[model samples]
Target chain A: MEIALLLIVGGVVVGTFGSLLGLGGGVLLVPLLTLGFNLPLREAVGVSLVCVIVTSGASASVFLDRGVANLRLGMALELFTAIGALLGGTIAFLLDERLVAGLFALVLIYAATTMLRLKPAASEDVATPTGEGPTGAPAPAGRLMAGLSGPNYRVRAPIAGATGGVFAGTLSAILGIGGGLVMVPLMHIAMGVPLRIATATSNLMIGVTASASAIVYLLRGGIDPYAAAPSAVGVFVGAAVGSRLAHRVDVRVLRVLFAGVLAWTAFLMLRRAAGLG
Target chain B: MSASRPGGTLEIRLAQLLRIGTYGAVILVGLGTALMVINGRSPLDVAPPLDPSRLVSDVLGGRPAGFIWLGVLLALATPTARVIAALRAFIRAGEREMTIVAGSILIVIALGVVAGTAGG
Candidate 1:
């Protein structure tokens, strides 16, 4: 009972930071369960997947209702992500536990670096294209490309975005992440999507991405219901609170603190991978 | 860029569906945890293997694990449900391209289920 309470509290902390930093709680939850509660890494991953599903589902609704998420773009990219998630889920059970841990540690380091360098107010004003139509819109492109365009920006380099989606989906399944860290940048930079729309669309996609692999974990009995239940509920609550408070908080300070946490967690994960924890 | 927005209704409906799923999951899972605590069952104990066939019976029998498992499954199903909803909307709107994309996503998820069942 006490342990369940602790798990809930831990999940709240993870979810709060995750929302504030625009991350899935899995990045923090997996480390907490494995290192703090002494759960095996695989079980921790399984639990984190469940938590990720909850957080994504809860937050996605708000993004969608606000009309910030681009459903067509998300669906198009998800075809590739779902395929990659299926492949990664199949591979997860076959890999060595230590190898997975090591991979996760590396991902954590990368995530930390990304967070440390995050510039939320960077240039979002994408320049208009040369071949402008009479109404100042970019020249009509292919059907799919035109469908992906938003009000303020035209999606570019879709092939690159789709390629990145596959990689992000694979990482999401294996590491129990939402892959927002990868997808946001891929959409914003490589695909010419605005950052706000990219983040919202990524939120819309992560639940589907996580669910594709979570089904595998469920079938294999990898998830612990006892651990998953409280943690998921906690994340649902924390995410709601965080999203509400997002505008009031100083995100720059939060980013620095979260990066520090990620770095420390990555070091611990490395130690565990080396059998020294 | 396109002149008019696409899939606006789809987004609103999907949002409602997602909200229902999330809230339902939280309630069911939270109830299950409370029941476990009340029954003196340790939430830290090794969990039983999830048997999909027995899910209905376990829930009927008021097993805490059953509720939790069901809730987890519900959460997993929510996103897939959104895909199905999107596919239906696209088909209704005569969007052949989007329908194809949504259909492809469903196929991928179906294949994932098959792989998991076979591998597990």
Candidate 2:
């Protein structure tokens, strides 16, 4: 009963904020599980991955409907993200728990700093056309460049996007957050994707990226649905609500608060890594 | 409304599929959660590790833990399913490069699943 309550509550909080920030909230959940609940890092990671999928499903579904999600862009980038996730999952099983903890701490700290420095998202230009012509169907592209670039805008940095995707995927699997923490900024800063598009695209891809890692954890018998189920439920619901409320909230304030949480979590993770916990 | 938006039909279909999957998973998981709470103990509470096959069987057998596991699987599968849908849509649209990219992603996912089984 207690565990169920904890998981559900934790999931709701994580899901709400995660959706608001265009993230999976795994970073927050990992620390919560490890410090508050005292679960092993790996177990927490397993649970976090499940919740990540739930959040992804909930938010991305809406983003797609609104045309905020760029499918072509997401698909193009997912190649490297999936590859990285596969490698990350394998390494997680092989690496020392403490090392993973230390790395997770670094991820948290990085997430905090990034959130702190993140500029306000550029204006909402998410309603990009879907390339439906007068005939109400899309035109066929004959070449590789056209296909890769898609119909929205040209992707300026395929190489950079791939590198960022790889980094995001590995960190996502290892840290349990949606790779959006890495992806959103990478797209905005390095790839020159608009902020709204960057976040939407990140949201769309996070699910596929997490799925790759989740399979490895599931096959390894690492994922515990009992621990993850209620949380997943809460997160799904919370993400729905968050998406609705996102526009009303002050993003800067939220980022500051989230950064604080990340900082604290980073401290806890580092403490555990140092064997103090 | 730039020149880079994907085919509208493809995006809509993928979104619809994902939404349906999310709803389905949530409903199943919610039902199982209610049962678990009422029963006062979950199969996963301090239980031994089980693989995907056993988990599916148990879920099919109407066990609460099984339902939860089924839900999680559905949630995980939703995105991969989206990717598959996109791949098909791209192929139908004759976007050869995109088809290859989607196919490669699927292959990677397949490899990950295989690795999980092997590593486990």
Candidate 3:
């Protein structure tokens, strides 16, 4: 009973921070379960996958309702992501836990750097009209790519986006993340998608990407129902609360503090990987 | 482009589906956790290994783990359900390219299932 309460509270904290920071709770969740709760790394990853799915389901709809998520583009890229997730899920079971930990530490360091350097950019950038011909019709780049073009912006370098999708999916499965850090930048920078659309579209793809690998974890008995149940429920509640409070809170200080915490956690994870912890 | 309109019928329907799935899973999982605590089981106890074949039977018997597992399954299924809904919408809209894209995703998920079961 006490442990269940603790897990729920811990999940709420992780969820709140994740939502506020725009990093999905899974990034915090795996570390919490492994370092704080002493759960095995693989099981923690499995549980994190479950939580990521919950977050995605809860938030993706709102983005869709706001017309920020690009559904056609999301679905198109998801094909490659799902494939990569399957491959990564399979590989996760084959790799050493320590190596996974090392990779996770690297991801944490990267996340910390991103958080420290975070800036409030205007979501509505001037659209680069790359794929359109005269008279506002699509250029002869074919119908599929043309269909992916948004009202204000035409998707550019789709091939690069698709390639990034595969990489993001692989890391998501292996590290139990939603891969927003990868997808959001890839879409906004490389694919010419607006920042708002990129974030929303990344949210749309995350659930499906996590689901592909989650099924593998489920089939392999990697997830623990007891831990997953309370944590998932708590995260769902916390995320709802956090997103509601997002616009009101000034997160600059919190982001810096959180980045420091993440760096310290990364150090501990590296030590654990070396059997020094 | 007609089919790709933002906040279109398809997006609305997809949103509704996701909301339902999220709420339903949360309820089931929450209830299952309560049931476990009431039944004198520690939530920290090592969970029994999942047996896919017994999910229905366990749920019918009112096993706490069964409900929890079912909820997890529901959560996992939500995304796939979204994809399926999108695929149907695309097909109904006569979106040939999108239909192919959605169908290919399903195939990929199916392949993942195959690999998982085979490896497990």
| Candidate topping DockQ | 3
| Least well predicted 10-residue stretch by lDDT in candidate 1 chain A | A125-134
> Of the true interface contacts, what fraction does each candidate have?
0.78, 0.72, 0.80
**TM-score of each predicted structure versus truth:** 0.93, 0.90, 0.91
Q: Give the Cα lDDT of each candidate.
A: 0.81, 0.79, 0.82
Give the lowest summed-lDDT range of ten residues in model 2 chain A.
A125-134
Quick one: best TM-score, which candidate?
1
TM-score of model number 2: 0.90
Summarize candidate 1's per-residue lDDT along A204-259 as a digit string, tens digits: 88888889988888888788998788788788888777766655678668778988
Please tell me how candidate 3 rates in CAPRI terms: medium
User: Second chain of candidate 3: TM-score?
Assistant: 0.87
TM-score for candidate 3, please give it. Answer: 0.91
Which CAPRI level is candidate 2?
A: medium
- The order by descending TM-score is 1, 3, 2
Error of 1 at A199 (Å): 1.5
| Predicted candidate 1 versus true structure: per-residue lDDT over B40-102, tens digit per residue | 887678877788898889889888888998898899999999899888887887888888999
lDDT tens digits, residue span A108-131, model 2: 888899888876644343332333
DockQ per candidate, 2 decimals = 0.72, 0.58, 0.78
- Residues A1-277 of candidate 3 have per-residue lDDT tens digits of 8778888888888777766554668888988888888888899999988988887787777778877689999899888788889888888899898998899999889878876775655234557667653345544377888788789888877777788889888988898988776787678766778766776787788889989988888887778998898889888877767666655677667778988988998998898788776
